[model samples]
Target: MGKKCNAPPECVPDYSKDEAYLKTVIPTRIALFESIKGQQLPHRQSISGNPIKYSSFTIPLNYSGMIILRNGSVKDGKKWISTPLDIAKGISKDWGENALISKVNGVLWDMLRPLEGDCEPKLFKFDSDEGRDTFWHSSAHILGQALEIEYGCKLCIGPCTTRGEGFYYDAFYGDLGLNEDHFKQIASGAAKAVGEKQPFDRIEVTRGQALEMFSENKFKIEIINELPDDKTITVYRCGPLVDLCRGPHIPNTSFVKAFACLKASSAYWRGNRERESLQRVYGISYPDQKSLKDYIARLEEAKKYDHRELGKTQELFFFHPLSPGSCVFLPHGARIYNKLVEFIRNQYWKRGYQEIEKQEFGLKPMNCPGHCLIFDHRVRSYRELPLRLADFGVLHRNEASGALSGLTRVRRFQQDDAHIFCREAQIKDEVKNALEFISSTYEIFGFTFDLKLSMRPDKYLGDLETWEKAEADLTEALNEFKKPWEINEGDGAFHGPKIDISVSDALNRKFQCGTLQLDFQLPSRFNLAYSAEDEAKKERPVMIHRAILGSVERMLAILLEHYKGKWPFWLSPRQAIVCPVSEKSEPYALQVKDQIHEAGFYVDVDTSDRKIQKKIREAQLAQYNYILVVGEKETEAGTVSVRVRDTRDLRDESIEGLLKFFRDEVAAFR
Candidate 1:
């Protein structure tokens, strides 16, 4: 059947079947969208008996336009001009193909969209964040198109994400289950669309027309009806799919060279449990196949180190449907978690910080409000200028069920959280100390980190001067550290400027686990005051909120993934295992385990009926740092043979000698 249309050619699909095309055609759910693409809505009617004529639209013959380059160069000519591509090619041929999007007069614009007027334009490529976001977001559209065509899915929302999380699209596929088995077909359809090089044409329509265009999909209708009347309704068309969006998409589908469907999961509509659930499909795309291969490799590595799987294997932590986001830490996991808290608490005492005990009725998502009460209870003096209070309070947040993942996104967690009440004169010093503390602490774990200072946001609460002062202090501290740092403009909390620390793991993936915010507004809000040095008046003290390990649960997840379940000896839950060759050596093995356990090392005695070698293998699989084997000769000689987890053998040493070496090794980690 032939499809007739009066719309521009670029607005329609450009599909071609080669000789290798499938012999059997699989029908798609595209007719609903295609019916309205090239025709006017029912509203365009003739009121009088005479025929009505609409104005003919055409490009001017001698359209003159000016282009502004980033280098302050201008290109002006008398030629027909519309899209950003025309302006780019007119300026320089090299920029025509790779340019991702343009910022015209501070508004993100699609390269294929016509320019409204002579405006300041900034073109961006993949290196720019704006460019990467637009590219990935457009990739989601391709994924959505493939899903709709292949399964007749009712699409909900598709968006791109940063921080190594690529993109996902939520769709309601009634009774049409999807899994990894369907990924290959979805990927093939998406790749075919890209090969067609269909233009992503943008169209502005009335709200009534938009409702009519997507009337078949109730989800789309619900979204359209909820949009405000003053909001402009725009839609983008590429290949066989049309979507309602306010897009700054790439010029065409061909820009996407490599793509893959990662996986699919269940999600509630608009993240509400009471509403209908949808299948959320996740995928990623890259500029080339090489990048995609690298990403796939990283993904494979990530799966091997996934905390949920590793937790089950290592017996670290587990989750139950009864308590959705709260983890049930096993004995071994609790030990490790407690050690992390103890380490941070020791630092508190050494850095002139006082420990504040948690209260009963005032517990909340953060311990800041309780710490505020502590500062207000006593009349502090400038002599005690920077009074630091530390807490390891348990916190609970009502994270959406759909958004919950392993330890990374959880409901219950503890933070190595603290608050420092300092005078204006001490802000710089306090922030400097916090940075140094972070560096020293991460160094112990062999973590290399990146630092960034977030400036005052548009809706910040404090006076401009205070925000600027806090920002200047943080900047100076960062500069003095003599390391590379980035400024996240307008990304600060409403109350203060903050410094975020992102740690890169062994796999070169980054996780943000530390934050230090200098708050001028919170102190005033809590009415926290201290006696001035003049001794005649009182003033509000600045509150600095800092967390070295933002969430202990999330940090544990990062460490598990980073080390691949092989923790350092100092932090390992099972530092060593005592295995005896025979029942005759069982008594000696028990003695050895007692010595290690009494010396503050976590050790277990394995007296299973299994052979010694088999026992050693089991311990290794459990990620035990050391395995000590004892037999008749070693027991009589008061010595033991120690084998490292990675098959490295050590010489048999006397029990006393072994104790000295082990203590020194553990001390080195501290």
Candidate 2:
């Protein structure tokens, strides 16, 4: 015997410390929830039996006030003074019960949050962005309540996601095996709370009172201690649970009519991997079950078109633990990637852009620094003011492992990046030309995109005069497009303003991939200048950073999912496959293959022992653009039967004619 091969108990394959711990503490957690719910958690009383203090409103009960609607009109000319919820209920019989949240004087106000004096009110429905956020954020609070009730978990942060994705809540569960099995328990608890229609009663508390109330929970204590002195501390109570939050929640838990727990994952405390790990639960809620059902159906469709799954099936790319967040593109994937770059390069030559040489070592994450160096290499003429430099430089970012996905969120990638240096007077024309370039690029890909001018952010560089001029230039440039555009207020980069383009995919999902930003800081920082008419003065040039496809890897992923792996002839990695009906037609298949290859197309012959029909079926499964079958009769007639990817047959066409069709399609993109 080889030393008996004995190991410690920890070496057992079936051992899981978290599972054992969860099994032990689950009963106690449920008992705690039952204990809390048995007693009424009144808004006026604290756990310490001290009466909670709340501020009183100064508005007189007998005073009548004006209620201004969003449409620049007053309801009934002048209405009696009431809360925002009452005003909403007066507008429509069921508005108060159905509306997600309200807006008073442009501020996101809660339904029960009292309105002061004469107010302009607007109610948001669940369909709008604001409404969706409020509704989902309220659902997150309910999730936290359920978690605490089911697992005695210490609550952390629960907030709505940016960009309308969804909402999630983070909590600390000590050695608990939280998985899909427990999602139903959590959902049941949340449903019970929703059925109770508990009001989201808000109460202001002092730091001492809050600390005393939550002394047992260390996470809450930490949050309360780190808060700024000027920040107000508020606690929200729903049914038997209370949480510390700055909330403009819905009127009641009933507003979250449709709810479900999505999934659970482990995260570090406040995203620091060195700290104690926590569990983050993601969920989504809707006002009705039908809407939730529709979303679920769409989600199922999304899973089918997921790029990671398709990438494996199509042999496009893969990820390894050794180099997480980075993708290894196979031969076929590289072909499509290179083709995209070549298409953009051809556009560069046609648009008066000169390709610049990239750096050898110490490569930067962006091409701006290198392009700036090239611009300053040797330049001193007003005629060369608007110099355009382009590069497809490989870049790397150290993204956290938890945030890494397939191609959508990756670490190493390349951008269709370029920088244009020009005089301030040519800002408008440069922006106009850039907008046109972006539009043309999207049109070629058959994408419908929307443009918006991102204004100056709170923290930005350069003088206000130059910033204002750049913003005006971008605004004027957008006016020339002759299309309806919106303004995204105070969302520009730290350097300067920019025009962002968001494209809608085939699934009706929006992706913000293209941008053209005006930068006045980079050129000045690099000391780039050009000579004026006098040939003595050095004037700083304005730099414009633009990208149409953004990242090559991300664009490939989007196209893979957008087309569901059925690529068009121009972008397809494996354009055509030649299949022979029998062993005797092999020579004819090779001849046809050679003809397609001679015309600069990617073609291969199926020499396997399978039947011609089987070979054609495999080609279709492989997502080849075209399948060509050759038999004895076609071999003698010098023709091939063509079948498209989706089983559409094009009887028999001459080899030259088929090659011409593919060439024309490829040329259109070029």
Candidate 3:
């Protein structure tokens, strides 16, 4: 990072005696923002700190027209003069009061930002993603004000997390150390900003103006220097602090009725360890106190089910500083991982998929290119039209260091990845069948799911007609699958349109783990072709990239948390444990364990000195699916007493009977 700006005299607080330099002792800035913003000169160079440069950039506000709301209601508006908030008020008083953000023509437009043209409007309240993100984002700016006023920190960047909640800001605090003890002052300052009900005023500024205004802060200067010459440099002011942002912020600061400082940590500037270190402070905000309280409760509840903690206790996985974003699976973790792969393999078998393998170790980001070569290896007739290929080979990509999280975001991972090469006529059937496969699999894991058909992005790989056809196929497939799905406009891969699946776990948290992406670009680029039914012309097959368990490592994490370590019988590493009631029955317990293991199930014999009850209790705590107890009567009868995990049900069963039961559960995919 550039050298951090020291606490300049203007930055020095008016209320603190510790201020070695105060506003009264400092030279005045060139001009107040309000006084200079109205200057429309094409190239104004007369400025104090830096030579000023102004652009004649202006938004046209002359077009008067009608805006069509999503519900078909029409509102008269003037382009660049009217905003989503104005149209929202035309709809209803409640909408005007509660709308945190609005979608103008399916784009996330700020409620306060002027409409560019006549468009359809959809207002979002705090319950929606757009609204919540804006809410948290606005709160981050308030936090920025707090840090600026109280600590004189030079703010770097503040953004909502990619995770489901909250926001954080990275700032340069120079030599001032920060910790939880500093949270009180931060909170007090944030509260002061909130109480002021400052409007989030936004204005387009000249590059020279931006430089002169942020002349004291090199961090902001570095960002300003990188923008394209014609790009609009917008600034937002809330209370005393002004920031450069691409904002769709809430109308004002008072929207954050509840706020809390989460934590403080050290981070390298822009996530590059070679750069200067900065302080990152995280916080969460809500429009009401109750929501914040519930979020805190969930945080506490989530700790009990955190996958990393469970991984430690269950001996599942471990990470080392030497290998960031890569996990080493212990024997137990390997069992769980392999079990998931095996489960998907079983589905692949039932789904008519041919397993394919490729080299890994960061050589490729996905198995797509290799599979494309497989399909293009030779000319074939239309008879083998829908060729399906499956792979569990590891894949690697260069994920940013800051973006890596536990297993959810990893640099190295494997997926139950597959590709289907089929005819265009078969698109709906293939997609519907894929949906069925996903439904059955998620049902097994007890996950409820949501579907969205993402359309072609603005910058796409193929012709518009191809994209339209692909989107239509996905839309028809989603409709035929009879699931409620929404359109994610312009959210598709550049290669093609896709169906994105999000599964909700026990905590009602959603994870994007399944997808069916239709790709036309790869097949065309690979020049793959098959003989048509007429046996004269060659036809290119459409490639459908399918993934149920998107990433094996991520799925492991989700299942670990979703199941709360109570792995189902089929997936459990500790499927069964044979406990000997006494030393005399040790041999019997070993025999029983051997039998169960021979039946193709994971089984262990507990020969420890602990009493049978304690052994059973420990096994249950370890999340063993089954506990088998052996004693004199059971030994004589050649039977074992069995108890299911987390249950009071127990029964005595013959060795043959237990093996049969194991086979049944495996067959049923229990």
Winner on TM-score (1 vs 2): 2
| lDDT per residue as tens, model 3, 565-653 | 89988888889999999999999889888888888889888899999889999999998999999999999999989899989798999
Displacement of the residue 21 alpha carbon in candidate 1, Å: 26
lDDT of prediction 1: 0.79
Candidate 1 residue-wise lDDT, 412-526, digit = tens: 8888889999988888889889898999989988899888788888678978988888898888988887767766677899999999888988877878889999888778888
Steric collisions counted per model: 0, 0, 0
Candidate 3 to truth, TM: 0.83
C-alpha RMSD for every candidate: 10.1, 8.6, 7.5
Candidate 1 displacement at residue 587 in angstroms: 3.8
| Selected candidate, larger lDDT, 1 vs 2 | 1
Model 1, TM vs. native: 0.78
Candidate with top TM-score is 3
TM-score against native, each model? 0.78, 0.81, 0.83
List candidate 1 segments past 4 Å from native. 1-131, 148-154, 172-185, 199-248, 320-322, 456-458, 463-465
Sorted on lDDT, highest at the top, how do the candidates line up? 3, 1, 2
TM-score of 2: 0.81
Error of 2 at 583 (Å): 2.3
Stretches of candidate 2 above 4 Å error? 1-73, 76-98, 102-106, 115-123, 200-247, 379-382, 450-453, 462-472, 479-487, 532-537
